[model samples]
Target: MSDLSGIWVAIVTPFHNDATHSVDHAALRRLVQHLRQAEVTGLVALGSTGEAAALDDAEQDAVLDTVLDAAQGLPVIGGLAGNHVGHLHARLAHLNTLPLHAVLSPAPYYVRPSQAALVHHFQDLAERSHAPLVLYDIPYRTGVAMDLHTILTLAEHPHITGIKDCGGSLDKTQQLIADGRLQVLAGEDAQIFHNLCLGGAGAITAAAQTCPEGFMKMYGALREGQLKEARQWQHLLSPLIRALYAEPNPSVVKAVLANQGLVTTISRAPHLAASEEARRAATQVLDRVLREARHIGPESNR
Candidate 1:
C-alpha cells in the first residue's frame, strides 16, 4: 500500500510453549505494539522466522488476521509461502478476503523449477490474488537460485509490486536494480545498508522483529549520507544477528525475547530451543542492542 518503501519487518510469530505450531494472539498484540512504536514501515506475518511451515492453514489465517487487526494503521503483508504453487494460490485466495497490503510469497521450493516456471507461477499468483504480490527469492531456503534475467522478466508484470531478495548476492541484486523498475527490498538482515547503497529499497529482515529501531537507525543514517555512522551501527548489530540465528532462528530469537520478558520462547517441531549458553549470549546481545537502540528514538521494539 504505501508503495511498500522503508523498513518492513518480517515479524516472528510468538508462541507460548516454544512450539510455533500455534500462535499466541496476546504476544502478537504486544509485538504489534513494538513494531508500530518502532515506526517500522510494514509488517510481514508468518514469514520464515514465523515458522509458517510448522503451522496449519487455520493457524496461518489466524496469524495474519490477528496481526492485521493489531496493526491498526500499519500495512500488513500476509506471509504466504509454501513449497507448492497450488497451496500458495489457495492461501492467497484466503488472504484476499482480509485487509492486507500484499501477498508476500516466497519462491516455490523443492525439486527446483525453471525460471520460466517461476515466472508463470508468480504471474498466475498475481492474477489470482486480491492484493498486490511481492516475490521472495531466497535460494538458500528454496535451493533454487533465480537468475537476474528471470527476475527482471517477473518484474515486468505490473501486478508484481516488489521483491524480498534474500539470495545474498549483491552483484545479482545490483543487476536487478539496474535492469528493472521493481521495488527491491533486502531479505537478509545483514544487507540493509549495503542494499540501500546499491540502489535497492529497504529491508524486511527477521531480526527487525526485535531490533526495529536499530535497523531503522542504520537505514536513517545511510539515507542521510552518513555511511560512517551507518557502518558503525551495522557493526553493532552484526553480532546480535549471528548469535540469534546460531540456533534455529525464531527458537533462539523467541528465547531471547522471553528472557527479556517480551514473549514466550517457543518453537514447533523440526526446530529446537536455544541452548542455555545461546540464551545467555542472545540476552547479552539483546540488552546491549536495546540500550544502543534507544538512542535511535522510535522506542525499543520489545
Candidate 2:
C-alpha cells in the first residue's frame, strides 16, 4: 500500500467573524504552515474535525485549495462523507482534479446499509476515485460498523489502500493488522500509543494538531524501539487528549489552537465554542507539553 504511517493531522476549518461566517482562508493557510513547521506526516482537510459537514461546496473547495497551497508538498488527503452515491461519485471526480494524495471516506451515516451493500459502496468509490481510499470506520458517528469480514473483503481491492480505524474494537483492529492488507491508522487519539505499539501504522488524529511535535516524538520513540521514552510521552499526552474531547472535538481543539494564536476559538453553529473551564484544562495540558518539548528537544524522529 501507500505507507500511510506516521502522524497525519485532521486540520480544523477556521471561520471568519463576518455575518456570512465564511471560511478564514488566511488562518487556514497559517495553520497549514504551522503544521508543516511541526513536521506532520500529512494533512487531512475537511475531515470531521475540520467541520466538513458545516461547509458548503464552495467553502470546502476554497479550504482545500488553501491547504494544498500552504502544505508545500505534504500529502494532503480530502475527507469525503455522505450517503448519496451519485453525488459522492461526482465529488470524487471533483477531487480527482485536485492534487490530493487520497480521500478519507466513511460509511453512509444513518442509512446503515448492509455489509454487502457497504462493500459495493466503497468498491464504487475506490473505482471512481483517482486518489487512494482510506476507509473511515467510526461506528459511533456513522451508525454502522464494517465487520472484520467486510473490511478484509474490501482490503482486497488495490485502490482501497488503508483505513482510519475508529471502530474502538481492539479485536477488529488486531485482525486487520494480522491480515497484513490495509495500513491501519489509529483514528482515536487516546489509542494512538496502543495502536502504534501493536504494530499498527500511525494516526489520523485531531489531537495531534495541538502538539504535533509531541506526537511525532512519541511515534519516533516507538519506531526506534525506545519503549520507555514512548510511554513517557504518552503519559504526558494522555491528559491533553482527554481534555480535547471533553466537549465534542474541534471545539476544544480550536480553543487550544486559539490560545497559541494559530487559529481563532470560533466554531460553527450546533457546535458551540468550548467553555472556559474546558479550554483552561486543555491549555494547562498544552503548557506542559510545550515545556517538555523545550526541555527534551523538538527533534522528532531523532
Candidate 3:
C-alpha cells in the first residue's frame, strides 16, 4: 500500500463516443498523463466525479483498470461506495486483488445513520479491507456527516488511513487535525490554501480535472511559503470554480477538459452537458486567471 498524503484528484471519468459510460482508454491515459505533468500527488478513481454510482460493477472495474494503468507509479484509489455493507464488502473483495493504494467509502446515504452505525460500518470495512481506508465525508451527497468523533475512532483502526472531507466545515476539520487522529485532505478546490493553513495535507479538487497546472501552482505557492501569491491565485480561480460548478458537476468540468482537447464532450444521459453559454462563462474565468498568473504562482512553476 502507498500513501495518499497530498493533493489528489477525484477524476472525471473520460468516456468513449456514443455518450455512454464506457471508458475511453486513450483519453483516460492522457488525463492521467496531464496530472503527472501538472504534478498532482495521486488520483481517486471512480469517485463522485467519475460518476461511479451510475456505472455498473463491470464498468467501474474497467475504469479502475484504465486509471491504474494510466497512473504509471502514482497511487490509485478505487471508489467502492454504497449504503449497503454487503455491496461494499463484495467490492472490497474484488479490489483486494488489485494494486490500488486504498479504497474510499462514504457511509450509507439518504437514510442518515447514527454515529454508532457509522462507526460499525467503518469497523467492518476496516477489518476486511486489505488496503488502507479513506473515509469520504461529503455530507451534501451522503446526508450523513462522519464527524471528527466518529472519524477519530475510525482512525484507530489499522486500516483507516486518512480522509477526503467535503463537508466544507473548518471547525470540524480543525477538530480532527487538533485531535491528531487522521490526516485531512481538502476536498474543495476553492479552498486548498485555506485548508493547508489548518494542517490540511492538500486538495482533491474538481477544477484540477481541467486546469491542473493552475491547481498544482496553488499547492506550490502555499508549500513554498508564498501565502500572498497563493491567496491571489485562490481569489483568481474563484471565478472558474463558480462557473465550473454553476451547473451540475462532471458535466461542466468534463466540458472544460473537452475544450482543452483533453477529454470527451460526453457524459451519461440524464446528466446534462455544459451548454455553450456555460462554456463561455468558464472560458472567461479561466482567461482572467491565466492573465493574472504572475501574481499567483511561483516563477518556476509558472
Candidate 4:
C-alpha cells in the first residue's frame, strides 16, 4: 500500500474573473507551485474544497490535468464522488490512465446506501481502480455516515488503504488509529493537531493552502517529538482555520489567495464570494500567523 501519510492539501480550482468563469489554468499552476515550495506531502485535486460538484466532466478533467502537470512529481490524489455507479466506474477508468497517487471517494451522496452497500461500493471501486483508494468519510456532506464496523470491514480490502475522516467521532478516529491497518488522515482542519497526536498519518487540509509552511512546521514538530513547538504552530494557525470555514469552504480561502494575488475571488453559481467580514478576519489572522512565524525565525521551523 502507498504510504498515505503527512499533509496533503485539497487544492481549490481557480477560475478566471470573466463572464465565462472558465478554469484559470495559469493561476492554478501558480497555486500548485506555491504549495510545492512549502513542501507539502501531496496534493488532492478536485476534492470538496476544489468545488468538484460544480464542475462538469470536461472541466474536471481539465482541472485534474492542470494539477497533475504543475504538481511536478508531487503525488496527486484525484477526487471521485457520485451516485451513479456506472458513471463512477467510467470516471475511475479514466483516472486509472492517469498517474494519480490514489482516488478519494465518499459514500454515494443523496442515495445513502446501507452499511453493507457502502462496503460493496468501496470494494468494487477498489477492485476496479488502478491506484489505491482512500475512503472519504464526510457524513455531513454525503448525508450518510459510515459506521466504524463498516470502515473496519472495508479495510480488509487490499486496495482500500486509508481514510479521510470527517465523521465527527473521536472514538472512531482513535479506534481507526489503534487498528493499525488503514492510514487515518484528519479531514477537518481544526482536528489536524488532535488527529496527529493520536497517531494519525496527517491531514488532507484545505486550510493548509493559505499557510502551508505553518502546517508543515506543526507536522514536523510533532514528528520530531517537539510537542511545545507543534502546539505553538497550531495555536497560531487555529484562527485562520476557523475563519476559512467561517463561511462555506474555499470562499474565504479564495479571498485570502486573491489577496496574495494567486487567484481571483470568483466562485460559480450558488456559491457566493466571501463576505468582507470573513475576508478581513482571514487577512488579520493570516498576517499575524505569518508575522509570528517570521518572529520565531527560520531555525525554529527547521
Q: TM-score of every model?
A: 0.92, 0.97, 0.93, 0.98
Please, what are the lDDT tens digits per residue for candidate 2 over residues 218-253? Answer: 999899898877888998899899999999989999
lDDT of 3 by residue, 1-302 (tens): 34666678889888878735477888988999888777788888988888887788998888888889888888888888887777878988999989988888888888899999999988898888888888889899999888767888888887788888788788888887777667778787776777887767777777876677777777777787887777777777788988998888888888888888988878887687788888888878887777877655455344
Candidate 3: worst 10 consecutive residues by lDDT? Answer: 293-302
Number of clashes recorded per candidate: 4, 0, 0, 0
Task: State in Å the error of residue 59, model 3.
Answer: 0.8
lDDT of each: 0.81, 0.91, 0.81, 0.94
Q: Quote the positional error of residue 146 for candidate 2 in Å.
A: 0.7
Residues 1-302, model 4: lDDT tens digits:
89988999999999998998899999999999999999999999998899998999999999989999999999999999999999999999999999999999999999889999999999999999999999999999999999999999999999999999999999999999999899999999999999999999999999999999999989998998888788888888998899899999989999999999999999887799999999999999999999888755336646
Evaluate residue 10 in candidate 3 and report its C-alpha lDDT on the 0 to 100 scale.
83
- Between candidates 1 and 4, the one scoring higher on lDDT is 4
Highest lDDT: give the candidate number: 4
Candidate 1 versus the native: TM-score?
0.92
